[model samples]
Target: MYFFLINLSILDIGAISVTVPKSMTNSLMNTRSISYTGCVTQVFFLIFFVGTDFFLLTVMAYDQYVAICQPLHHERVMNRTACVQMAAGSWASGVLNSALHTGNTFAVSFCRGNKVDQFFCEIPQLLKLTCSDSYLSETGVILFSVSLALCCFVFIIVSYIQIISTMLRIPSEQGQHKAFSTCLPHLTVLSLLVCTAWFAYLKPLSSTTSQLDLVVSILCCLQ
Candidate 1:
């Protein structure tokens, strides 16, 4: 639990740091400009951190599932080596996913303009500016990401189902409460993260940016 939480906190800091610092600097300096390379870098690390966050959440759910449902083998199942490998795998997945996104996004020709409608260099906004026929490649990447997220969501749900069943078998009301207390917050955070991310990425793209888009984009970032 501590391993996943600490990794998640670090990922959150990295994710927000990717774009927030630049946005704040621009706000204070009265500038609306980010260089092409800077925008690409921002998009890369943002996706990396965000992807890692989701993976870590999934790991944490599995960790809890093992702890609650198979307490006898918890130590054996989640040994130090296993924990390190899981954490490393999460980071690797994030890096590879981010590389795919960054490569596909920048490979497109930006004929519309360099100006991004959102505060950060988001994929959807970048796609809006793309003029080449290859934009569908990036769309495919988004679809794949959404599919992976759904798979993770399903995995968590299944884990929780077993967890709930196991909790009910426990005779003590306090034990149930203790188990629920540990799981509920993780569930809430996962729901918010997945829902907001899906809302941001899976929604229909608008040809023209609107106030609503800005609001939704901000909400996604803050999450």
Candidate 2:
């Protein structure tokens, strides 16, 4: 689990660093502009890191399930090779997903002006600038991404159900309390991340306003 935790920490750092430094520079310099290349790079890395973070979180949920519910088999199931494979798989999938979204997002013609409403080159905010068909294509890609996240969410939920059930069977009050303490916070964050991301990305843009986009985008990125 420490291995997975390490990867998560790196992803969190990378995700925030991708935008925060440029943001701080802009704030200090009193300028709001980023070169086109810089914006593209930001979108790519942000997608890559954040996408891997989500996958890593899902894998960690499974790690916990195995640790708590199948302790006897934990070593065998999550041996060093298996752990490495899982981590690598998460990163590989993140790269593929990021590449798909990044390519599709920039492929659209941007004529609505380059003023991104949000802090970074967020896919949704970038979509707002498209005069071409980014909405149609990017929506498809975002839905695909969202669907994958939901699948991970479902897998985590099922794993936790097994975890909680196994915890309930622990016979000792202290054990059950300990288990609940561990599970509740993870579940809470998972719920918030999934809900906000789905709402922010999938909701109809026409019905939404820039202010709402700004707020939701902040929630999506910060979490």
Candidate 3:
């Protein structure tokens, strides 16, 4: 748990550090700006850390699920080997997915319009700002994003379902309360995260009006 928490802290720092300071600097200077290389680097690293965070949260959910719903077999199920494998898989997937997205994003050229709408170089925002043709790149980005989102969503749903089923089997109200208490924090955080992510990225791609953009922009900054 300590190791996992430390790594999670690092992931959180990486995710925010990639964009926040730069965004702040731009804001202070009264400029909406990023260099080509800087933008690409930020985009790649941001994707990597975000994917890592997703997998970490999913793994944590599974860990809680096993510890709660399968207490009798938890020891054997989440032994040292299994724990190591889960961590490795999450990190490896993040690296590979980020590389793929970065490559695809770079394949789209920017002829003139280099201004990204959001502070960070969001794939959708950058693509829209690019004067170059980006049908293929945009399609690829959508596919990758959807795949990751669906995978995480399914795992979380399954985890919660199993959790609820197991909780329902408890005979006493006290037992049920104790069980639910352990998972409530995770559920709350996951709900907030999913809602915010959907609102930020899954909204209409063509709906980047100034007011809506500022609201989402502030949320992103706060996050």
Candidate 4:
């Protein structure tokens, strides 16, 4: 889980790095201009990492569920081979999802308009700028993105529900306390993720340029 989290952090850094430096440079120059290819690359890599993180988080939640709920078979169920397979599967799924989304995104030509509103290239934000008829692409992207997000959310919530229920079954108060304490770090990370993600994608896209958005973006990068 830690290894997967670290990879997600690095991918976040890469996504942020690709966009922030250019945005800062433009701000200094007072010209919000990004090259056509640069913008495409930015959107592609951003999608890649975001998808990758989603899969990584889902895998981590599953790992936690197994560790907490199936202690007797934890080692057998999550042996080194199984753990490696889970990691590989997450990585593979992320790559495929990212590629699919990115391909759909670029299928709609941008014409000559390269003025992106947000500091980073987001899917919805980019779609808004396309000159081509993007109804099909837009719908597909939204559904794809939402499905992954909802799946991750449901899995995480279900895992926690089972975890909490199991903890409540402990006979001793100290055992329950310890069990709950084990989840504190994961809970903190999940809260931050949900909050930042809500602001970034759930809220109005027009509001992403605010200071709050930047702070959230920065926080995500730090993770």
Q: How many residue pairs clash in each candidate?
A: 0, 0, 0, 0
The TM-scores of all predictions, comma-separated, are: 0.96, 0.91, 0.88, 0.83
Q: Highest TM-score, which number?
A: 1
- Residue 77 in model 4: shift from native, Å? 0.9
lDDT measured at residue 143 in model 1 versus the true structure, 0 to 100? 86
**Candidate with maximal lDDT:** 1
Model 4 regions more than 4 Å off: 24-31, 203-223
Q: Which candidate, 1 or 3, has the higher TM-score?
A: 1
Give the Å shift of residue 189 in candidate 3.
2.2
- Clashes in model 1: which pairs? none
Candidate 1 TM-score to native: 0.96
User: lDDT values of the candidates?
Assistant: 0.88, 0.84, 0.78, 0.74
Q: Give the per-residue Cα lDDT of candidate 2 at 71.
A: 86
Name the better of 1 and 4 by TM-score: 1
TM-score of model 4 vs. true structure: 0.83
Error of 2 at 101 (Å): 0.5
Worst 10 residues of 3 by lDDT: 214-223
lDDT of 3 by residue, 109-185 (tens): 77646666677887777667655456576676668777877888899899989999989999999999998898887
Query: Candidate 1 vs candidate 4: which has greater lDDT?
Result: 1
What is the C-alpha lDDT profile of model 4 across 1-223, one tens digit per residue? 5666676677667767766788789899998677767877877776676667767777777777887888888779888788778778877887777777777877887764565556666676676677746647766766877787898899899998999888888899998888777778778877787787777767655723677777776665445
Q: List the residue pairs that clash in candidate 4.
A: none
